[model samples]
Target: MRRPSLLALTLLFGTSIGLAQTTVETIAEGLEHPWALAFLPDGEALVTERPGRLLRVDPQTGGRTVISGTPSVDDRGQGGLLDIELHPEFADNRLVYLTWAGECDGGNATHLGRGRLDGDRLADFETLFVAEPCVRSMKHYGSRIVFDRDGYLFMTTGDRGERDRAQDLADHNGSVLRLHDDGSIPADNPFMERSDVQPAIFSFGHRNPQGAAIHPDTGALWIHEHGPRGGDEINRPRPGANFGWPETTYGREYWGPEIGPDTLAGTIPPIHHWTPSIAPSGMAFYTGSAFPDWHGDLFIGALAGVHLAHLRLNDGHVIDEERLLTDRGRRIRAVETGPDGGIHLLTDHVNGELLRLAPAAR
Candidate 1:
């Protein structure tokens, strides 16, 4: 009567995943450590390279044009240019939002910025959010952005390799933050009235959350964070709740010592956790008609497992799971559902690629 780990699940069901008849094609190639992508209204996409380049990729010709005005990034270990997202009213405003690791006092910190798309350059650029009290570490800068129905933006920040920082109210690390479109902290944020807390903090005690998405029907926020050695988590964090990480984890250290007590008081448990760590990255909810049976399912890209995971859900609970693209053996860094009922994937590497998955028979 116990749940199995991701390794067990992969071994049990990896070979049995029967995917739909799909054709895989490399749409764009030669990207350097690509991290995230955002689709434009004109059938093109803006792709981010970890070395701080932003390229506008043409869907048809597989061509790329480097967009000007991309901010300088640290580009160190697990750092660099990251998630990109377009405004909900992008068609009218032509605004794009970006998150990356920027140089701080003596280290790098996650920074979110917004700019207007004007020809091949980003004009009127402005910094939206930047983590505070940056420490000198090369890892764990959690960065992802998702917008809600009301257009408010939510973002994730990691513990910056400091476990105890997660439990601190003043540290921007290890927390989910909410802000208005123009970088102003939301007045209604849970901790806004608390003098000891950051007004932008929505939730705290998170580790390195790599992916975030808004539920289609429920409008709730869901995020996936990496664990130390195992125990990766997918949590639906409510406002002001604590998601236990170093304080309490189901994971063990890389050298085999147990983490914390594995259960901390007043912490909300993950809805689903992968014990053997899938290294889950970008995720999307399939609402497209191209895959009828897959509609309403959640798809997450895996880095360590090197597969695309599909989790079937009913009323927010995962009922079934499947893994695809295991043979390719590439680290999938980002995944998104296209407007044309197809799936777009970005492989992470020095020679990364933008891939498309479509119905083969179509």
Candidate 2:
């Protein structure tokens, strides 16, 4: 039964003192600034509403439906409608992939789409990838959209707030894209025979990479970014690696100072960092078993540290940091894992909620 010490299980999982034994279940609510959620192999769920709607929910009775075509996003600040997925064959290819905020020239960027759901809509929805030199600033749009183990499709761009164009590899914003699940460009990307890069660059400076996971036992491709008021990172991009944002920061400059050189010779630090900033969003890595001591652990989704950032890996580092839902003050935007293993969460305000976390029945 031994397995404690990670700061004594992070101060005994303190978040209202380890959720007073846990139970918080509010599976669905009005949702407005939702942004990303996936799980539909009949379990019913597929939400994403950063003001551009696209739901289907019904996590056992909360009920919902909208979803029609979607796309045409660009909902300003922090941009809209981001990250969602479901096609790892998706029970015979019903597809469904996303990552929004695209308007181009006069504004927004970071796009990538795919469709074929047919009931709540989204039938021929195309538009595969559009992150580029399109800066009108709504904020960095680095997204999240996994799908590897040969299915390809990586995605995550941001650095759109300029910051030296994340060391500019001729564009694709801050990079981490490796397409080819229909969005093309994966002819062995690592800068595809470089003629000055951008052939779906797979790893670049990156500065706003909202979470993206897939390392249940080393499947690789892990991420988490959004520093500034203080560096918040976590990496493993590797494929032509370069992660150094603003030159190699451990973070600074939200009116502060120090930004380049906490370590930079070629760049590639951060296996985990989070100084005063924890605005992380959407992530998962708990292998399931209904939280068998949180299986593999790693759960970020902390909009400015509002909470739910648990960590605790050992071989790959990040050894312990609990913090769940601090009494449900709510801000966690998207975090998934359900097929019954439970642990849904997705609350990013304007009246949003989707929670689930189990083990409270007594």
The top-ranked prediction according to TM-score is 1
The C-alpha RMSD of each candidate to the native structure, in angstroms, is 6.5, 17.1
Summing lDDT over every window of 10 consecutive residues in candidate 1, give the lowest-scoring window: 1-10
How badly does each model clash, as a count of residue pairs?
1, 2
Estimate candidate 1's alpha-carbon lDDT, on a 0 to 1 scale. 0.86
Off by over 4 Å in 1: 1-19
The residue-by-residue lDDT of candidate 2 on 77-147, one tens digit each, is 88888888978897787989888888877767889899989887989999887877778888888888899
CA lDDT of each prediction against the hidden true structure: 0.86, 0.82
Query: How high is each candidate's TM-score?
Result: 0.94, 0.35
Give the clashing pairs for model 1: 158-174
